[model samples]
Target: MRTLEETLAWVAEGTALCRRAMAGLDETSLLPGWTRGHVVAHLAGNAEALGNLVRWARTGERTPMYGSPAERDTAIEAGARLPADRLATWFDESARALADAMAHLTADQWRSEVTTAQGRTVPAVEIPWLRAREVLVHAVDLGTGVRFADLPEPFLAELRADILARRGPANVPGVHGDPAEVTAYLAGRPHTGVTTTDGAVAEPLPPWL
Candidate 1:
């Protein structure tokens, strides 16, 4: 990813983008599996969860992102039912609070190790990437038409690297297209019109997150 400033800027940009998408949405379902409220609620919950990790890094405590998987799911579900205006506010406010926490981190805190919900131990610096990925990727998942091609190149590159590292070596023949499209497909979004070395893909690789 880019410098922390640049990465945090993307975080802001993504938050704005998501807020716009959320604002334009009605109580109608998001056209696939979820409602706009559900997606917005998830974003809010995610910002709070990521903030927990940031606090852990700053204070040298072992704060886990979520209390438990079940609690996380419950929060998202209940949050989805909140009024649209309040849900959007929660989304924006949580992100701002997280950014505030990030801004106060000392140099030493940047290198402090933290545990992710998935049990991975990584430097606190990775928290921004986690937020950026959630905001951008899940924005697309919102079905707001924020396609993969809309994501910035730098974010896509880092996202690709993160996903590949997690999934290990690319075992299947690779999908080919523009860098953003390939990254999108690999990151588990639908990348229609993309072709594998053997032509049309009958199956996709495992998800990135």
Candidate 2:
């Protein structure tokens, strides 16, 4: 339930973080089995796919994020293989296009129902949250330096809530520590400082994302 303005600012900042992390880098990302090139390409592909949803909202045409799961995976792989300079341009252009699409949605259009790549139906207003989550989380996943602690506090809480809502409660032992600590655990990121309510170490959790 974030306001569009707030989400846009967060996306912009996260995009900047990602840009810095991927600059001149063709190395491994924090994500296993993904290079920085893979990460950047995925981001660029995601921007375009999500734009499809926005277009559906605006024009009442039914456009799914991708034609199929295989199509999506293939697209990411193809983009990842592009030359480094071309890959950067793809990300930059796609990001700009998505931002522009989000900015131009009318009030009624924002209320349009759109199905996510995950098959969940949500209002178009949720698009911002979806894109925000991508850039912000992937920025940290780039592992060039950004961490959960660097994210806005409110967004952390929102992310935590969203994860729990989908994953069904914080089944891990302990109440956990700060928002960043809990969010880090939920996101499957490396983190310390999380402990149970009674000072016991929090149990490791299965991947939620």
Q: RMSD per prediction, one decimal? A: 2.1, 1.5
Q: What are the per-residue Cα lDDT tens digits for candidate 2 across 2-79? A: 677888888898888888878544788877888888888889989999999999999999999999999888888888
Q: Which residue pairs does candidate 1 place in steric collision?
A: none
Q: Could you say which candidate leads in TM-score?
A: 2
How displaced is residue 13 in candidate 2, in Å? 1.5
**Residue 190 in model 2: lDDT:** 78
Whole-model lDDT values for every prediction: 0.80, 0.86
- Backbone-clash count (model 2): 1
Query: Which 10-residue window in model 1 sums to the lowest lDDT?
Result: 23-32
Each candidate structure's TM-score, on Cα atoms with residue i matched to residue i, is 0.91, 0.94
True lDDT of residue 22, candidate 2: 82
lDDT of 1 at 151: 81
Query: In model 2, which regions exceed 4 Å deviation?
Result: none
Q: Best candidate per lDDT, number?
A: 2
